[model samples]
Target: MNDKFFIQAGALLGAVAVALGAFGAHALKAMLETSGRADTFETAVKYQFYHAIGLVLIGILLQNCAVNAERYYHWSGYAFLVGVVIFSGSLYTICFTGIRAFGAIAPIGGTLMIIGWVLLLLAAGKK
Candidate 1:
């Protein structure tokens, strides 16, 4: 909700993304390849990393935002966070569990990420 919260969340998410990426590259490499989900796993890691950075930027923007634009930043931050969790989380789940049903959820996450960017655009448009 607030700048501090988003900053903290972003930092934590970024750290986790790095850790997960390393784990996937090493420990899970054979399994992922064997399952033919290596690309999907990498995609999840990439999106997570990208959105973690976006979250940090949104947090910083919130910190410097005009009062009237604060709401947009707040919503954008939430959208980014939730989007990453859903998008990457679903991919990760599918990679590990081999449950293709989770694929359906990835679109929702992508949509949320898109909404986050749109909200960020609106916030930027504000004076």
Candidate 2:
């Protein structure tokens, strides 16, 4: 894939993270009356934003690096995207909808995050 695509995706995810964070603070404040749940949701948003920034870095690295590590970078980007959607998305849904089913998906997202991190490590280790 093109570096531009990853950059754009990263930027978009970053913007979304901010929007979701704000929404959780203002709009969902009442809905997430329990402080613990609100905190958990906020944590999810924080990690999502961090990983989004990581994606941007990977995009930049892909553009500048002499060696083409497209596969690793692509996997990292996809994992991060999926992780954010599942991890943060599930938390937001559970917080707002009070649906217990969303909880089951949270682990899947967390696993994605672990995989993303491992991919990043392997990418860095590559010669």
Candidate 3:
């Protein structure tokens, strides 16, 4: 992806994460209280926000790298994206539906996030 695209996507995702967090904290407070899902929702928002920043960093790193740097950076970006979808998406579903299946998927998302960070570190280490 282009720098502009990555930057814009990051910004948008960051904004959405923030909004989701606020909504969970304030508007959903009562709902969460009733369902006992506040912590789960917060967890989702946390990872979403963290990966949103990762997305921004990936964009910045990509902008400064050589052509050969694209592979690792691109993989890192994809991993971060997958992390957000799987982690946050599963949390949201579990919170709303109380399904253990969603909870089961959370670890996969966390693994993706770890892999993304590792890939980013490897990319940076390359000289």
Would you give me the overall lDDT of model 1?
0.93
* Model 2 weakest 10-residue run by lDDT: 64-73
User: TM per model?
Assistant: 0.98, 0.89, 0.93
* Prediction 2 TM-score vs. true: 0.89
Please tell me which model should have the higher lDDT, number 1 or number 3: 1
- lDDT (Cα, tens digit) per residue for candidate 1, span 32-102: 99999999999999999888998899888888889989999999989999999999999999999999999
Whole-model lDDT per candidate: 0.93, 0.82, 0.86
**Ranking of candidates on TM-score, top first:** 1, 3, 2
Sort by lDDT, top down from the best? 1, 3, 2
The residue-by-residue lDDT of candidate 3 on 1-127, one tens digit each, is 6766667767877899899889888998999879999988988988888888898998998988877777888898888888889999999998878886878888999999999999899888876
lDDT of 2 by residue, 45-68 (tens): 898898889888878877865364
Q: Where does candidate 3 stray beyond 4 Å?
A: none
For residue 42, model 2's alpha carbon misses the true position, in angstroms, by 0.6
Q: What is the Cα-based TM-score of model 1?
A: 0.98
TM-score, candidate 3, is 0.93
